[model samples]
Target: MFTSQGPSLRELAVQALSSVERGYDLLAPKFDGTPFRTPDRMLDAVEEALAQEEGSFGSGLDLCCGTGAGLGMLRRLCRDRVTGVDVSAGMLAEAARAHPEGVDLVRADALALPERLWNTYDLAVSFGAFGHFLPAERPALFGGVHRALRPGGVFAFPVGAPIPVTSPLWWAVAGFDTAMRVRNAVWRPPFVMYYRTFPFGPVRTDLERAGFTVETLPLPPFGLREDGSPRWRLLLARKPAAQYG
Candidate 1:
């Protein structure tokens, strides 16, 4: 419905009625053509932000990496292995088709990531998938990511400015979340997606509780809101490197 190449209205309705994993499986082929795909401008901005960090890394991981939108950037930053993990098999297949080489695409849940992920990865990133996770699930999600990384590995993602109540977009976002909640209430296999669930304050606290030292950097490419606050911020969650006596 978004464009000629994007999924049709009926396709989107079918996806919305199915579980999140099944929905993405149906949408995988045309996912990139849809607005759901993270924009290259945002990805490039993130890559630029990561570059300013400590020089080249040994490996990188794209947590919940969807169609692998961030994989190419991870490939550019990490000197060695680059991997993409997602719960959706169809999404991984699309990622594999897109990346073709220099990436290990694994199918796994972000909330219950495998033990094999321990102490691995110098960097990890995710984009536009936060809405899939509910606020109550943050602990498991963050804790799993905490365990997935090696000492000193960084996890980064962007946070857009909170929509002001006066803005039309605020109502639109609120309405969408309301609709999703209603849909989930009656549906058997709930399609979990909500816009307002990932507030930064709770999220930062969750990350810190999960063992990350968290901070934020403004992404200037997206510019500032009228209030002078940044329109977007890059959240960095760093795991402390191992120390010994």
Candidate 2:
């Protein structure tokens, strides 16, 4: 579901065939025009939830920030500085164009953050980027986020509920993930993206192992399931103020 301004089918095909970073670089310009951009409603809900906790943070970061969709949300939530980091230079260029004033765009891989960034952020958020990481990579990704934040700092993002196996939506996502796998199998610099891989239970466990006290707050914007469980939730993981040595 892309807007008229979004990339054409051929453009999308080219992106899918390229490496994840290159693919995103190709898609960076029209990224916001696609459904891939994190919705404002989810962003607002997270801002509200984080606002309830401690005082305003000094700096914020959007890890795997892409074209900086989450940067604006961080700017609203953090009073001081807001920065976005991604591996795609093209994405950073577009982000720079959009946020010229007081926004720092860093081109860096999320998996291996620069040592200078360790424990430097007050808050961090990522939007729709987790699926790019494999399940085995969650621990390191979570650890990097943990190290990027100060003690008691937060790392948050929205996670949607899994579609029912019986639903057409399930088939759609399954088919998409399956096709992505097939494409990666046949392609070089494989596009390491999958939809159905991230699960809440394993994520929480990894977060805990990474020294974060994880919590989930339901997002009303996406509403609830038939069983009244939230269809979408914001995962807020805090690096504890003190750690047992």
TM-score of every candidate: 0.97, 0.95
> What total of clashing residue pairs does each candidate reach?
0, 0
lDDT, candidate 2, 74-185, per-residue tens: 8877888888999999899989988888898888889988888887888998988888999999988988888889887888888888778999989998999999888888
Best by lDDT: 1
Task: Residues 1-245, candidate 1: write the lDDT tens digits.
Answer: 26688899899999999999999999998899898899999999988888986567888989889898999999999999898999889999999999999999989889988888777888989999999999899999988888878888888999998989999999999999999999999987999999999999999999999889999999989999899999999999999887210
Worst 10 residues of 2 by lDDT: 46-55
Q: What's the residue-level lDDT of 127 in candidate 1? A: 94
Off by over 4 Å in 1: 243-245
Deviation of model 1 at 26, angstroms: 0.3
TM-score of 2: 0.95
